[model samples]
Target: MDVPVLETERLIMRSFRAEDFGPMSAFFADERSFYYGGPLSAGDAWRRLAAYAGHWVLNGYGEWALEEKESGAFVGFCGPWKPGDMPEPEIAWALLPEHYGKGFAFEAARRALRHVYETLNWPTVMSLIEPGNAASIRLAERLGATAERKMEIYGREAVVYRHLPPDLLKEQFA
Candidate 1:
């Protein structure tokens, strides 16, 4: 699959590379990764990285590796995701704790949402956020998404936040 690269003012959203595993593994090993299905072993991290790549091959779209342009550092990932068990595709994001307060996730998510609506022609998108994950919930809200319902994902409870379509999002800024 050919993963298209995207860019924002401070980030280069591109395809995952083998070099990304180091930072990805570190993020997954930290407690901060709890909400993202982590505190995982290095092997698991590798598998997760491979899964993202595979998702692109099978689904035509998947998460992008977030790279900070200035320092060329790997920050996190954000994009459309839908595993077999998910009810629908969702705009998802995860960032290293060190990069948390910098607005990278929000920037990446907004761009990814636009890609879904504009490029992928998806009518709408949702974010399945874990209940206790206040930060992610806030980010979803910030992206003009509102809670639609609660559901279980792989046995864990998640709140489904539905995002406004591109037209509505444009009106919001207008």
Candidate 2:
């Protein structure tokens, strides 16, 4: 299935394309972008983007390149994917440092979560965040995700946040 393009007030979340490589490479090359995810060389970032795009063809869902609607600029990425060893599907996102503190991450993430739950019909979605990435952890909490456990991913310790079925969470939290 083609990943659908989603729009928010200030952003457009759409599939990756070759034209996105330059801005994506710049974002990936930034140390701030790698603060929690780890540094990646330009080549590595390009390869990853290629793989991510291919995943859309293979899995029916993949990361959407987040862009500013007005400026038509690539800002970052957000969507769903299953990591190589992850036991459950995950909703993940990252923003270029310039876009931080502007609520872009949260806005895009909310749209992705809605797609996962309402459109994709996923019963649960989880975020595996680096323990030190307080910003992401807090964002997950604000989305009604609960910290489920601590686990290791890509050799780094991470806190797993889970958003269970909305009805189930309402029944339990209510």
**Quick one: best lDDT, which candidate?**
1
TM-score of each model, paired residue for residue: 0.98, 0.90
Question: Per-residue error at 86 for model 1, in Å?
Answer: 1.1
Error of 1 at 155 (Å): 1.2
Alpha-carbon lDDT, every model:
0.94, 0.82
- Local accuracy of candidate 2 as per-residue lDDT tens digits, 1-174: 677889999999998989888877887777776643546788988898897798788888888999899999888888898856777888888888887888888888888887887778888889888877888988888778899999987778888899767576455435
Superposition TM-score, candidate 1 onto the true structure: 0.98
lDDT of 1 by residue, 49-108 (tens): 999989999999999999999999999999999998777999899998889899999999
Backbone clash pairs for candidate 1 read none
List where candidate 2 sits over 4 angstroms from the true fold: 168-174
lDDT of 1 at 70: 99
The TM-score leader among the candidates is 1
lDDT of 2 at 41: 84
